[model samples]
Target chain A: MSRKYQAQIYVTLRPSVLDPAGVAVASGLKQLGYESVEGVRIGKYIELSLSAESEADAKTQLDRMCDQLLANPVIENYRFEIAELAASV
Target chain B: MSRKYQAQIYVTLRPSVLDPAGVAVASGLKQLGYESVEGVRIGKYIELSLSAESEADAKTQLDRMCDQLLANPVIENYRFEIAELAASV
Candidate 1:
């Protein structure tokens, strides 16, 4: 039988890519008197749940999902942590 | 001397709040044939670097930053992980 799993995926822009949005936020923070803040980068965080026969199966599917849709491989990198969920009562 | 620290912050909508953007993404994924996907919630992932005297100091500052700017208290919640960086030459 299949088991439930939850994945916390983080998608970030490659370091070489410029993040204007992050810069804007940094400036905003500076204006608010948070002068110590530096080098801010913003990205996408996705929480997804699915079911698979095993942990290996879930990981393989998640990797495919990230490569195909969750992240733009050309300019973004993605990583995720997966954990099996307790079976529902 | 102060040391560098990195903070990974995740901001997500409260469960009771509607997530239209997440719904759109889930539907998009479904169209792409990932039918097993469920409870897809999209959130903001932010990476920030700063200098602080210690880990506790960094954590305190990050908490204030999130409260004031990074997350909305009304509809969203935020949590973070902090790592101390080696001193630069």
Candidate 2:
């Protein structure tokens, strides 16, 4: 039997990379009177739902998904959390 | 003394809203041979650093930031986690 899993993945730029979009958002917040926002960095958050035979299998597939399509490993780092949703009938 | 806080914010499309970007990504994944990807939803992940008098103050500021600039309340939902970094000297 296969289990349903939900994966929440976060892909962030490496600290060494410049994030112009984040800088723009920070400035926008400041202009809108959010003076306390000192800095901001923006990234991608993705949710994926899938079915796998086991937790390890789900994780392996998720890892490959991130590496192959979800993230650009050169300048971005990706991490994910997988939660079991249900046992598929 | 004021404290430094780091905020991680996730902003996702409301369930009722159609996510064309997610649909595109799902098809892209399929083309890349990730046939197991049943569904995909894309969102925004933001990291913020700021100084606040207390945790409560930080939370309040973060909420306002999200409402005012970080997220569109009509079509998106946002949530955030805050971690205390250090006390200002």
Candidate 3:
């Protein structure tokens, strides 16, 4: 039987990279009324689905993609999660 | 009075941009046993804390940052939200 999969990847810049957006948002939050916020960092989330014969194969392919295309090793870092979809139950 | 704020920015490549990372994650999920998964797209999330005197000013500055530095207008898009922290509650 064919199998389906889902993956969520989160990407972010290294702390050293300047995050003007993060700073602006933090400032905006202060205007809105959140007084306890300390600092903020921004990142990315990517979700997708695909087919694979086995979990091990899927992980291997995914890791390659992350290293080759998904993330820029020079500045950005990424993490991902994989899960199976329930079969109509 | 001093105020604290938080901002969360979500960034993603335009649909036209190729997302190899997204594809790999989808494939990985399929291998893990998810047979019903469909397509996936990946993006970014950023959270930050800062100080602001008022909401309007904060929004203005945040928008400027998004347009100027946070997001790459050529390929990526970004959105943000700001909220205040309750005092001693």
Q: lDDT per prediction?
A: 0.90, 0.93, 0.69
The number of the candidate with the highest TM-score is 2
The true-versus-predicted C-alpha distance at residue B55 of model 3, in Å, is 1.1
Q: Residue B22 in model 1: shift from native, Å?
A: 1.1
Better of 1 and 3 by TM-score: 1
Model 3: fnat (fraction of native contacts)? 0.72
Give the poorly placed runs of model 3, Cα more than 4 Å off: A1-38, A48-89, B86-89
Of the two candidates 1 and 3, the one with more favorable lDDT, higher being better, is 1
lDDT of 1 by residue, A1-89 (tens): 77889999999999999999999999988898878787899999999998887889889989998999889999999999999886642
Candidate 1 chain A, which ten residues in sequence have the lowest lDDT sum? A80-89
- Please give me the DockQ of candidate 3 compared with the native complex: 0.33
Give the backbone clash total of model 1: 0
Report the poorest 10 consecutive residues by lDDT, candidate 2 chain A: A29-38
* Residue A77 lDDT (model 2): 98
TM, every model = 0.94, 0.97, 0.54
Give lDDT tens digits, candidate 3, residues B1-89: 65666666677889899888867766765676555457778787777665666767667667766676567889987778888754321
Write the residue-wise lDDT of candidate 1 on B1-89 in tens digits: 88899999999999999999889888888888888788699999999998888889889899999999999989999999999878753
CAPRI quality of model 3: acceptable
Q: Evaluated with lDDT, which candidate comes out highest?
A: 2
Ordered from best to worst DockQ, the candidate numbers read 2, 1, 3
